[model samples]
Target: MMVAIAQERDRAAFARLFAHFAPKLKAYGMRAGADPHTAEEIAQEAMVAVWRKAASFNPAKASVSTWLFTIVRNKRIDMLRREGRPDLREEDFLHLEQPVETQDETYEANETGAVLADRIAGLPDDQALVIKKAFYEDKSHRAIAEELGLPLGTVKSRIRLALTRLKTTLPDS
Candidate 1:
């Protein structure tokens, strides 16, 4: 019967399935402590999922009842959690992040970083020291000038010149 629904999308087969399982699912939800209306919704949701996922059902793995009750069981848990977690957003869970880094991106980052380091090293000592304080040490331009006993404009100029030289000198990968 499930195979009929999967192969043919037979409405009669679906109707028979619903007739057999819907009430039982509802009763199961209620026994699991969902309210009456929630139990009804759970049964309907489980049946819809079964109808849509019918093609995925494999008799080789599980009996029809076992597979179906599993759906009902999951739906019941979802309903229970829904009641408990009113703040849950469906959209928040719709997309999952792929955390794997591609080989190309990793290689490019390492190469670019090495080029940047070499470029910074090639800068004049005064410019390189100011740039290092402003960027690497996260010092403000005024603070860098005060600490080095130089004028603010001189510190800013050094940083600007250092950046322009690095940008023009670094190899674009």
Candidate 2:
């Protein structure tokens, strides 16, 4: 009957196949934990797959029942996977807002930054360079050592001395 449907587009063959397998497929879905509506949907989709894939079926591989059951199982898995995903909606995005700083906060931040830069400038050249690379340029101490061709210990010492001097001079935040 599958071969007949594949070769001739036989509606009678398909009707017989659907009639025999639809209820069984639906029951299989329910036994596997689907609700009645979902089971019915799975059965209908599986039968549609059978009709579309009839040309690809091989009797040597498995019987028709095995093939139909496999299609139904796959369709059930696909449905479950789709159901597990969260649906996106415009309302879900409406609550998120980008932070905006007020004018006083922005001025305070700029003033603090300027004070920090002035304190760093007061350090000796080597200590100031290390501090700038480590904090302003965002380089690691080891990377600063490599770039400056200084020993790792020398780079670390420079950063420590710079921080100690700045701490003594700067007011507590």
Candidate 3:
């Protein structure tokens, strides 16, 4: 019934499709290391693709679940590729600006640092340590693990889990 309605480009069919798969797709994104907001966006994008491509769906060739999962997987891969590519704007030196060293600026900078430090301290010790090593020390997970005498998998898992927890705990933008 849904397949026939979707084949005919019914709006209700699309809505039903989104209701059924969006949560599942978002879960998939979360498992793939994406934050909840990003996961929701990816799921919506995948559903839109499903709506647009419904005419091409062949139930005999593949189930709707398989098609939806494939779309979500491809979207995630595309997002990762986009993130791995350096931003051209950042690469261009024209956008760079020198900071003004006024008294107010110095005070603001110190306050910002204090706030950041407090936030980091509030996190679990393991998470704080991993984040510090990755960002402050600019070290790779493998290097950090070796330096700490920890297994590489343990380090990676800790970081991933920390990020997931942070995603939920941090205030939404």
Q: Give candidate 1 misplaced runs (Cα > 4 Å).
A: 82-173
Candidate 2 achieves a global lDDT of: 0.69
Q: What digit string (tens of lDDT, one per residue) describes model 1 on residues 9-44? A: 999978977876788778777766677898899899
lDDT of 3 by residue, 1-173 (tens): 23544566788767766676688788777766788998888898888888766666554444355456567766776774455533332111222133222333224434544655676777889888997777534367999999999998999988997777554532221
Give the per-residue lDDT digits (tens) of candidate 2, residues 1-173.
76787889899989977877788788777765678998899899988888888877654444465466567756776785555434332111322132322333224434655777788878899999888666434367999999999999988888888888886643232
TM per prediction: 0.47, 0.47, 0.47
Per-candidate local distance difference test? 0.69, 0.69, 0.64
**Residue 43 lDDT, candidate 1, scale 0-100:** 93
- TM value for model 1: 0.47
lDDT of 2 at 152: 91
Q: Is candidate 2 or candidate 3 better by lDDT?
A: 2
Q: Which residue window of length 10 is worst by lDDT in model 1?
A: 91-100
